[model samples]
Structure formats: structure tokens, C-alpha cells
Target: MVKTAKKNKIHEQLTPKTVVIKIAKWFLILFFGIYTLFPLVWLFVTSLKTNAEYFDNPFSLPAVIQFQNYVNAFSQANLGRMIINSITVSVIATFINIMAAAMASYAISRFQFKGKEAIFAMFSAGVMVPLNALMVPYFTIFSRAGLLDSLNSLRILYAAIGLPMSVFIVRGFMDSFPREIEEAAYVDGCGFYGRFLRIVLPLTKTGLVTAATFQFLTCWNEFVYANLLTSSPATKTIQIGIRYFTNQFTTDYVSMYAAIVIAIIPSIIGYMLFQEQIISGLTSGAVKG
Candidate 1:
């Protein structure tokens, strides 16, 4: 009788959540999952429909797939060129962003200097500043310097803007790292760059990949700044190319959907390829921390 009472008592404490609460939690998750996935499902459906069919039955599946829309989207809009341009810009920006943020984060985490806390505070403060507010001044400066409308110019700007947040994230991850590894490497005659390149970087590879992936996505899909800065066809990115299918009076929804599907290809591939890295980095930070 005493053992039974004790077992009952333990069960009471462990099973705090009632059946009704569990049911409600599952319902909430199901609702959110559908809400998030519905748009992507709609996009694929729309891409397969003709313009008339798309407008007439936005929710309905196509009777016959209009695969020509994909062909037209690329050929008519010169999306191939835009894809190449976006890839180049994104790759360059991602490289610069990851390198700058990684070095800055490592320095801030490991080194001791005067005003160190104040400098870290300044960097933290920069995260709260809105990029939109600085656009006017940035435009004026870039204009005077004759860097506006150039691919290299835009890359530098994107990397600079992305740096503050990237540094904070990387620094947060680096903070959880033990100092003994770095100290041991130092003892073994590894200088700052040597230790960083050979030891620190290998250990933080997942975090670096996460940062680079985000930077690539941002650089590739960035429309507002790219549209605002570059007016020439040669320098325009995929986002700009996608906009060509839309106008004031008439909009080619089929073509637009096709373009969107095409644009998603690279990002999807990137995510799939680096998913393991992202998962590992996030899980390590959450669980190990």
C-alpha cells in the first residue's frame, strides 16, 4: 500500500499536463504548420496554371500544366543573366561578411584591451539601428564617390550592413567555447592567424556556414536596395528580373510565379546542402550552452 501511494505521488508530479492541454497544444501546432506551408503550396499550383486559369481559379490545381511559363520566364526576362549576376554578388558578399564578422567576433571574445566593454557595447548598440534611416546618406555618399550602380559597390554596402548582427551571433557562439583550446594552441607556437585558421575556424565551421548561408540569401534576394541603386540591366539581380513581369495595368501572374519558382531553386539547394551545418550549430548552441 505504501509503495503504491509513493508511485502515485511520483506520477502526479511528472504528469502535470492534463489530456485537454496536450490536445490543445497539438491543435495549435497543426494550425501553424498549415498556415506556414499554404503559401508555398499555392505558389507551386499557380506556376502550373495558365494566366487565365490562374486568375479565374487561384486556389484550383491546373487541368494541364503550363510548363512553357518557366521557359518564357527565363528567356523573355533574361533571368539567366540575373541569376549569374546575383550569384556573383552573393558569393563575394558572403565571403567578405563571414571573414570580417568571424575575425571581429574572435577578437572581441578573446582579447583584452582598454575600453573593451565600451567597444562591445557600441557594437551591440549598432544592432538596433535601422538600415532604412541611413539610406539617404548612403545614397548621397555613394553617388558622390561614383560607386552607385556598380556591383562591387553594392557588395561592399551589403557586407557592411550585415556585419554588426553577424558579429554578435558569431561572438555569442564563440563565448561558449572553452579558453583552454586557444591557450594550448598558443603554447604550441600558433600565432593569432595560425590558431584562428587551423584550430578555431575548424571547430566553428558550422557557425561560419550558417552565417555564410544567411548572407548569401540576403544578398541574392535583396530587392529594395538593388532596385534603388542599379538602373542598368547588366547589374540587376534576380529580384529585379522577377519584377519585370509586373506592371501598372497588366501583370503576368503565371510568368511571375514561374520566375519566383526559378529564383527559389538556388536558395532551396543551398538550404538543403547546408541544413546539417545549420542544425548542428543551432542545436549545439541551444543544448551545450
Candidate 2:
């Protein structure tokens, strides 16, 4: 009876401490959540404020909602074309990057050939190289090939830049999958393409989605190559197009804020939708022995 009473007392003491720890965890999450979301809230607020209200009464509430800012942003900068161009480039680059990386990762992960380890190591070393040094060579090659000032140039560059990282991620996920799965497909008379497309691809959907999301976001946000490669307004992406908000005379804060809010919406929606898959893919096989 004494022992039972002591055990109960110890458990009761631990319960409050556990509850306090949980509260602390939640409080920390709330703090970071508000901290992260505050900028987005401010962008929306600034978009709603008029130029006069923004300058004259900077801290005061907006006297009137300004719907024209969004309209002007779309019409003045030809942002509609820019959005379309960005969408096309991001989608094309992401598809090529994910598919090519998946194939390369599968080969490196599954197959055993002579000098394979050396080749894989070489590929891995690319992850450490800085992109800035490659810009001159890229410019020269694209110019010589007559690909400059074209959408194809943007797509190719985005895919090339994103490939090494995607390869690393897809290879990691592929390593976690069992070889027996592919062998079973082979037993069913599946060839290399069939085994890869039917057996391997389905299992790696989470990893592929994560890779594609990352590639899409990277391509969409890329500005240096876009600004350097494209000359015409039709080929310009939203990131480059946003520069129009800063003309030589004065910057249009209201229009710029609205455009930024608009541009961020698509990426946020995509990430939220694939949040679970991305988390799982990123952490699947880091501890394998």
C-alpha cells in the first residue's frame, strides 16, 4: 500500500511538468508562426493603403481600399505576360529536372558498374560548386548557340542549375527503397523502362513531388539568368518584371507591394498542398547504416 501510494505521487508530480513542457512547445510554435506571418500581413496591409495614406499617414489605418494598384500593376508592367512566361519556364524546367534526375539517381543508386563510385562522387562534388563563377561560360555558350533572349535558354539554365540538388535528393530516397520491388517487376517480364516507370516511379512519388516543388520554386524565383538572357518584354519573368516598380524617378511602393503579394500566392499554395510529401521525402533515409 505504501509503495502504491508513492508511485501514484511520483506520477502526479511528473504530469504537471509534462503539461508545462507541452505548453512551452506550443507557445514557441505560436511565437514563430506569428513572426513568420507578420511580413505577409504587412504586405497585404501596405497593398491596401493608398499612396497618399502610405506617405502622409504612414502608421495610420488606410482610409480607403486601393483596388487600382493591382489593376495598374497588371496593366502597366504587362505582368500578365510575365506571369505566363514564369509559369511556362518553371513548369518546363521542373519537369525536365525531375525526370532527368530521377533517371540518373536510379542508375547511380541501383546499378553496379565499374567506376560507378567515382562517377557518383564526381556528381556529388557539383553540389559544393558556386553558381556565380559559371555565369560567364553560360553567357558565352548561349550567345554562341543563338539561344540568348529566348525562353528555351531560361528553361535549359533553370533545369541545369536545379539538377544536381534533385539528383542528391532522389538518390537518397531511392536508396531507402528495396531492390526486391524492382526484381519482382522484372519477374513479371518488365524491362528497364517498365520496371522504372511502373515499379520504381510510383514508390518515389513523394520524393519526386518534393524535388519538382523545389525546382519549380527555384526556376520561378530565378532572376540573374533571366535578366541576362532575355531581352523582350514577353520573355521576362515576374522577378525581373518587378524591377519596373523602381524607375529612375520614384519607386511605386503600392504597386510593388501588390505585385509581391500576387507573386507569392502560387508558391505558397503549392508548398501547403505538398507539405506532407516534402517532409517525408527530405527525412526518409538519412540514418541508414
Candidate 3:
């Protein structure tokens, strides 16, 4: 009788409210999962279909899989050159932005000096500045400097644009880090650079990966700046190269879809690789200060 009563009491603890909440949570998860994945699934399906098939039955599976579309998309779009350009620019820009932001964030987060808050505020404010607002000035400045129409110009621009957000993210993570480690290093005669290079940097790997992922994606997908600044075929990025498939009159939907899939692969791979770190870094410092 006693065991039966206790079992009844325990089962009653899971109230109707709790059951409803659980159901709602799963509902939201299913809803968003379908919403996010449907577009990618459709894009893949469209990429495999011929233009005639696409026109005949857009939503149905491809009657005959056109593997040649991928090859045509690659060669005709000159994605080979564009992919190389995007990787080079994104990699170099991400490296420079991460290195500079890490150093700046470390100084700001660890040091005490006049205008420290002000400096941090300035970088944070840069995040609000829209890229479109600076497009004209960037064009004029680069044109006069004889830097337009070159990959170096794009590299520099991408690095500069990514700096503010990187600094903000890294600084937030640094601020949340325990200071005892650094103090102990100091007592052991470790200088500022040594402490930063050895202890702080390694401890902040999640933050660094988060910042690098953001910077790389920004540089890779950026189209307006690439289009405005770069005029030559050799310097154009994948985003800009995608425009070649469409003009005022005609649009190659199949090839264009294929190219989009190619362009998005790197970003998907990158996110999948560093998703845990990104989630951890974003949430770690969120409640710290």
C-alpha cells in the first residue's frame, strides 16, 4: 500500500503543464528543422533537374539526373577561379582579423588604462555601421589610391570590416575568463606577451574559433563590396561570378542552382566543423557581465 501511494505521488508530479511544455518544445524543434532544411533540399533537387524538367515539374524529382550540370556550372561559371579567389581572400582576411582582434581584445579586456571603455565602445559601435553606407567612400578612396580592381584591395577591406565584430566577441570571452591564471603567470615572471601567448590564447580557443568563423563567412559571402571594388575576372569572387548566369533576358536556373550549392558548401562545412565552439563561445560570456 505504501509503495503504491508513493508511485502515485511521483507520477502526479508530472503535471499537465509539464506535459504541454514538452509537447510544445518538440513541436518548435520539428517546425524549425523543416523550415531551415527545406530550402537546401529543394536547391539540391533543382540542381539535378534539367531546364525542361524544371519547367515541366518544378517540385518533382528529376526524371533524368543531370550530373553534367555540376560540371557545366563549374566550368561555365568559372567557379574554379572564383573559388580560389574566395578561399585566398577569406583565409588571409580571417587570419589578419583574428590576430589583430585577439591582441586588441586581450589588451582591452586585461589592461587598465584611460579611455579603455571608450576604446571598447568605439569598436562595438562599429558593428552598427552599415556596409552600404560606406560603399561610396570606399569606392572613391580605393580608386584614388590605385588599389581598386585588385584582390589585395578586397583582402584589406574584408579584414577591416570584420575587425569590429571579432573584437567584440573575443573581448567578451576574455572578460569572462578567470583572471587567477594570468595573475599566477605574472607571479612566475611571465610578461604580458608570454601570458597572452601561452595561457590566455589557448584558453580562449572557443572564442577565437567563433570569431574566425564569422570573419571567414563574412569575407566569403560578401558580394556588394566585391562587385563594387573588383572589376576584373581574375579578382571577382564566387558571389559575383554567380551573376554571370543571369542577364536581362535569359537565366540559366539549373546551372545557377548548381553554382549556389557549390558556393554554400564551404560555409556549411565550416559551420558543422566549429558549431560546438561557436555555440559555447556565444553563450559563455552572455551572462558573465
Pairs of residues at least 3 apart in sequence or in different chains that clash in candidate 2 = none
The order by descending lDDT is: 3, 2, 1
lDDT of 1 by residue, 1-289 (tens): 9999999988875674865677888999999999998998899889989988977879999999889999999988899999999999899998999999999889888889898778777877888998778888888888999988898878988898888777766777778878899999999999988988998888888888887888888888888889877889999999999989988999988989999998988998999999999888777766653
TM-score of each: 0.89, 0.91, 0.93
Worst 10 residues of 3 by lDDT: 280-289
Best by lDDT: 3
For residues 107-224, what per-residue lDDT tens digits would candidate 3 score against the true structure? 9988899999999999999999999999999999999999999999999999999999999999988988889999999999999889989999899989999999999999999999
Model 2 clashes, total count? 0
After superposing candidate 1 on the true structure, give the runs of residues whose Cα lies further than 4 Å from its correct spot: 1-18, 286-289
For candidate 2, write residues 1-289 as lDDT tens digits.
Answer: 9999999988886797888998999999999999999888888888888887888866566788888999988987889999999999999999999999999999999989998778778777888988877889999999999999999999999998888888888888898889998888888899999988988899988889988999999998888999999999978999887888898888888898889988888899989999998888777745675
Error of 2 at 206 (Å): 1.0
Collision pairs in model 1: none
lDDT, candidate 1, at 56:
86
Per-prediction backbone clash count: 0, 0, 0
lDDT of candidate model 2 versus the reference: 0.88
* Models ranked on TM-score: 3, 2, 1
Model 3 whole-model lDDT (C-alpha atoms): 0.93
